[model samples]
Target: MQTIHINRAEEMYDHPPIALAVGFFDGIHLGHLTVISKMIEVAEVNKLKKAVMTFDPHPSVVLNPEKKRTDYLTPLNEKRRIFEKLGVDYLFIVPFTSKFAAMSEKDFIRDYLTDNHVKEVIAGFDFTYGKYGKGNMLKLAEDRDGFNVTTVSKKALNDEKVSTTEIRRMLMDGEVEEANAQLGRPYKISGLVVQGEKRGRTIGFPTANVMPDEDYVMPKLGVYAVTLKQLSTGETFKGVCNIGYKPTFHDPSKSAVSIEVHIFDFHDSIYGERVEVFWHEFLRPEQKFSGIDALIAQINQDKVKAEQILRDMEL
Candidate 1:
């Protein structure tokens, strides 16, 4: 799929009218999939181009900078890959800046929608846009006639609305399996392997420390059975991950969270290389032990449990 920045949409090569789905699509969860599927259906039926229009850095980060918090299900790169897999022909990533946020509703429609050759717009029924999110699907439909508008109702699981916020909450609570059931895929965190203090190496369980992008949401601080994938080689490895401040070596002054993974039967330095870890099951909560010996013993036991879980998963 071709990715076009919001500011460059005007300069894009003209294509046939597009059936577009617009949203933040943080996770591209089942709820968002409903709209995308609808867009594809409409595009196929009308022979229009299938496209997706999404915002970057999230509107919340721009509109309420001070109050914003870290929580994103899928970053831009991951979202792009997922959209491609879903068969979208084009993906527009709009820069969510203060200037763009100040645009009037008509200007947004004229500049982003009408001028961009968007003939049909599909979104969730509760979708909002324009300055301060004053524009709603109903209002957009009422204001325009030339463009077709479709509003999809919320998709639900177990008769309850399935939303990215809910999914984030589940991950934060360390409900990996439940979250995966709702997401239709394991919860994944991608990052670059970076140098660590080599504490795990000294204990015989060498690990790869990954620092994820700022926008990525982290799961609860705990040990998890995970599947690690090397981006360059597309190699998959079963692993155990720990996401926390390492209470065993806790420092009150350090406010950052760290994610460390120990890949089974792998021992190659991967510093600076990118890796993706998919959480399959929550093994146990992160806890500090009395000393290094106890911690090592606990980790060994955790590894056994993790390996068994992976064997059972067989994914």
Candidate 2:
């Protein structure tokens, strides 16, 4: 997909008229996919390019500046990858600024829709835009400058709306299966392996300490079954990941949470290598163990369970 950063809508005027799916699409969950799929269907039928537009730094970053950090379920790069995989023709990233946030509803429509030659727009029923978010699907359809408007109803599973916020909540609560179902895939986090104190190695379970690449919403502090892949080589391994403060060996209050994955049957020193971990299941919460022997025994049990989980998943 061609990624374009839009400061002004005129920047997209030269391109072919596009059927656009516009949203923040943080996790690209099922609900977001419904909107995007509608865009793709419309674009194909109308012979328009498949396009998606998203805002950077999030609208909350500009509208509510006091919130220091906003974590994303899918970062920009990951979003681009997923969009490309879905066969999007163009991906527009608009910088969310205070000035941009202040743009009137009519001005926003004219600039981003009419000026850019948008053939149609696909948005969720709850989608809003313009100053103070006064622009709704009803308003967009009523304006009808040139482009058509499509509103996708809420997508849900088990009566729960499939949404990014819900996915983030599930991850933070250690509900990987539910999050994965909403996402239509496993929950993944990409990062580079970093050096550790070799504590796991001392206990015969060497681990790769991962440092995440972006502002990702982290999972609950616990032990999990996961599959780890070396991004460059495409070699995947079954693993048990522990996200915790190493309470068994250190004080939880004084330590930062760490992500350490013990790859099954692998002993290579992979410090500095990039890897992505796909979360499968939550095994147990992190806790302080009595001694080294107890810790090792528990880890052995974790490895066995992780192996079985991964095997069943593969089957």
Candidate 3:
């Protein structure tokens, strides 16, 4: 897939036009997938390129600078991976800035939609764009421009709507299974393995200390069954991950949250290597063990439980 980064209004191609799916697509969850799938179908039928117009930094961060916390389900690189997996032909990343945010509805249509020769636009029912979110699927459909619009309604599972917010809530609650159900895949965290205190080695369970990407949403502080895949080697391993301050070893007030993964039966120098951690199941909440022996015993139990869960998942 071709990725085009656009910070201003300009036409990249004009000959055949394109079918565009526009959204932040944080998780690229089921609802967002529906819009993209429809857009692909429209593109196929009309013989236009399949394209996606997504934004970076998120609109909330640009609009509300005073907020202390803002997290994403999938950062740009991860989002690109998801989009490429879905067979997108072109990916247009629009940098979200104050100036871009101030563009009015009509101007946005004229500059972005029409200028790019987006003959067909697909968006979710609740997707909004333009200054203060004045542009919506309805406006896209009613625009005087000769563009066809398709609005995908809520995608539901078991009568509940699938959404990024709900998925994030599930992760924050340590409901990895529930979040995966909404996401249609496991929730993933990607980062580089960094040097740590190497305290796990003393306990007979060496771990790769991951410094996760700051922009992604972090799951609740707990132990989880996860699949660890080294990005460079493409080797995957079953693992147990802990996401929290090492309460057993240090005072929480003085320590920062950390991600440490113990890959079963693996031994290698993975420090400085990038890896993707896919959360499969929530095993237990992070605890303040009484001593090193207690922590080691609990970790052993966590490994057993994680192995069983990963086996059942068959991934």
The number of the candidate with the highest TM-score is 2
Q: Against the unseen true structure, what C-alpha lDDT does each candidate score? A: 0.87, 0.91, 0.89
lDDT of 3 at 85: 89
lDDT tens readout by residue for model 1, 1-315: 888876754764466689999998888888898899999999999999999999887787777888674567898888998999999999988888888888888888888788788889999998887888899999999876468899999888898788888888899999888888788789888889999989999999999999996468889889999999899888889989999989889872575788999999898888988989999999999888899999999999999999998996654
Candidate 3 regions exceeding 4 Å error are 11-16, 66-69
* Whole-structure CA lDDT of model 3: 0.89
lDDT of 1: 0.87
Task: Estimate TM-scores for all models.
Answer: 0.92, 0.96, 0.95
Summarize candidate 3's per-residue lDDT along 62-153 as a digit string, tens digits.
88888623678898988999899889988989888889988899998988888778899999899888899888988878883868998899
Query: Which is superior by lDDT, 1 or 3?
Result: 3
**Better model by TM-score, 1 or 2?**
2
Clashing pairs in 2: none
lDDT of 2 by residue, 1-315 (tens): 799998877787778989999988999988998899999999999999999999998888887779633788898888898999999999989998888889999999999988888989999999888999999999999997999999999998999889887898899999999999999999889999999988999889999999989878899999999999998888888999999999988998898888999999997888999999999999999989999999999999999999988886661
Worst 10 residues of 1 by lDDT: 6-15
